[model samples]
Target: MWLKLNKTFFGTGTHIYLCAVYIPPLNSTHTADDLLNLEAEIANYSKYGDIALIGDFNARTGEQADYIENENNSIQFLQDMLPQDYDLDSPIKRNNLDILNQQGNNLLNMCLSSRLRILNGRYLGDSLGYHTYFSKNGCSTVDYAILSKDLLPSVEYFCTSDLNFLSDHVQISFKLKCDIKQYINKKDFNNNNMKKFTTYRWTDVSHGKMYEALNSDEVKNKILNFEITHFVRNEKGINEASKSLTEILDNVASKTCIIKVPIKQKKSKIKKNPWSDNELKDLKSKINNLGKKTKT
Candidate 1:
């Protein structure tokens, strides 16, 4: 299992935490305790952000018309392990199936206790004609996307597709309706546009020159005769006065100081790996070309 954290969802400041997991098949060496431990680990991250747990839990939920008994303890383990906040959702809902197996009963009991509504059941109605997983015996929906209550509104579509002909298990896709505009901040935009200048280094010679310029008869007279009334009588006027002062200071500094320009360094070439020679480079290039053609 792994947790993927996304700080930005479209343009909104909402955070989304997706926990992807896979429970071993019934015949595997892993025990029910292992599945319970995995659920506990997933629950630890749910408090940080909106959680969406999507995975293959090998439990045979008796939601299909031709339901057969499977001896998987995943459903019972998960039902006891998961927190009260999480909701189990699946495309396949109980309709044609008259009997509830151990897995189905455990899942149903968890939903009832948590007051969780299944997303597929809410949107797609009672039954799904298509199944997610196909086997020699029959087809069944073993994969699921369990989500937190807060994420339900954002869910747009949830269904299965048989696009991957190589695999028996069909892919399940879900769409979320995200509003991009909510993520942009106007204050950050204004801050980016604001101008900032670096302070000039003052040597002894430059300092003497600036002192002489400031003490000159013409410069002294300008400062003495300067009046606030010359500009408008508001915040804009104060800004104008500040701009004039800055201009005078800049002029003095330009005449006195020898401004330094930072030099840009040339980037050195990357040394090739000793093991990767011309033969490996040629092989990699051919593989990339083949991949590009396949994509097109």
Candidate 2:
């Protein structure tokens, strides 16, 4: 099982967590404690984000007529384990049968307690009852697309299709009305386009020329002539003044200094290895000496 949080621009910083899971079959060697542990792990993950746990849980949902052996403990455990935010409502409104089994009853009770409406039940009414899984035994709705209550409004459509040619389970599809925004880092904006000042490495020859330019009569008169009051009045005026100053400095630097292209250094890769007990002891000794050296 794994959880992936996807950020979208529904409002701002809206995240939808997709939890993919596969619970072991009830008849398998997995014990009740194992199932409880799995549920605990899922519950922990749910606290971090809005989650949609989807997978073949192997627990029967009483949405079909097929009389397969029910895993009562697993069914009840999962229903009890899910957080309040999860929607337990069946997406399909009508099943092949009118009555629900033990698993269905437990699921229904869970939904009622959580106040979660089923997406499939809401979209597909009694007339469009569909089965998700098929085999020699019979057709049943085993697979499900569960979502959080917050995501209920964003669900545009939800229905099952007959796309499973090789597999026993059919494909369940749903569309979400959401706008995804691409994440941009602030550091990416610090490129050459944003740079206004020309950078130069200071040397003895360049430093002497820069000193002469700053103290020159022409440069001093230009600085004196610049109107500080005109620039301080508004935002646009300040930008214009800054641009003019940058131009002046760039001209002076070109005349007084030699422009050198910056050298790009290749980063060295450091490989890490697990340290043995002796190595750890040696490292501790080094750290103790460093503290003594600092004191001295």
Best by lDDT: 1
Cα lDDT tens digits, model 2, 35-152, are: 3554455466557655565655444555542222244444567876778675333333434322354544444444444333345444643224466667898766655566666667
Structural similarity to truth (TM-score) of each candidate? 0.44, 0.44
lDDT of each: 0.59, 0.58
Q: Model 2 segments beyond 4 Å from truth?
A: 8-13, 32-35, 63-99, 103-117, 124-129, 181-296
What are the runs in model 1 whose C-alpha is more than 4 Å off? 5-7, 11-14, 63-118, 124-129, 181-296
**Candidate 1 lDDT, tens digit per residue, 1-296?**
35554566364335666656576765777567545565465466655666666767555554432222241434566677778775444333343222344554444444333333344333443235345678788766666665665667777767666635347787766766767556656665563343233446778787678768887886676676564238776779768887877777776777678765444446899899989989999999999999999999
- For residue 96, model 2's alpha carbon misses the true position, in angstroms, by 6.0
Q: How far is candidate 1 from the true structure (C-alpha RMSD, Å)?
A: 28.5
* Cα lDDT for residue 238, candidate 2: 60
* lDDT, model 2: 0.58
